[model samples]
Target: MKTIHLIVHGHIQGVGFRYFAQTTAQSKKVTGWVKNQEDGTVEAVAQGTENQLQSFVHTLRSGNRYARVEEIKVSEADQDQTYAGFKIIR
Candidate 1:
């Protein structure tokens, strides 16, 4: 399994981006948490197979109709962290 940290930029906040990400992650069988950052960015950490993670990233870039995703910064996450399911961190 692979874990990745993401900082999603653009018109994401207050647009249900966290819900979108949680749905996508659940569909892909990825376990993680997504939350809105203080800097008007969306932050997330997802764990899954490489293919699953890649697909997740792709979907995030596309975003939901209400959200216009400009960029997503991805990087390897701490391997020790694990989650039972996908969630939106309020």
Candidate 2:
């Protein structure tokens, strides 16, 4: 398993971006936490198989019809984060 840091940009705030991400991560059995950034972006750190992480990123791009994600910055994280389930951090 691996940890990936994702920064999603564009019309993502106040449009259920965090919820969608959390739900998607859970459905994929991924461990992570998502939060709204101060710069109006959505941020998440997902830990799972590489394939699962890719799928999660794909969902962030296409699964959200109501939320238009313009760009996503993804990178490998230094360590694995233990999370029982995905959540939207306030």
For lDDT, the strongest prediction is 1
Q: Model 1, range 1-90, lDDT digits (tens) per residue?
A: 999999999999999999999999999999999999999999999999999999999999999999999999999998897899998999
TM-score of each: 0.98, 0.93
How many backbone clashes are present in model 2?
A: 0
Could you give candidate 2's per-residue lDDT for residues 1-90 as a string of tens digits?
889998898998888878889889888888889999899988899999989998889888874667988899999897735777787899
lDDT of 1 at 63: 97
For model 2, the run of ten residues with the poorest summed lDDT: 78-87
Off by over 4 Å in 1: none
TM-score of 1: 0.98
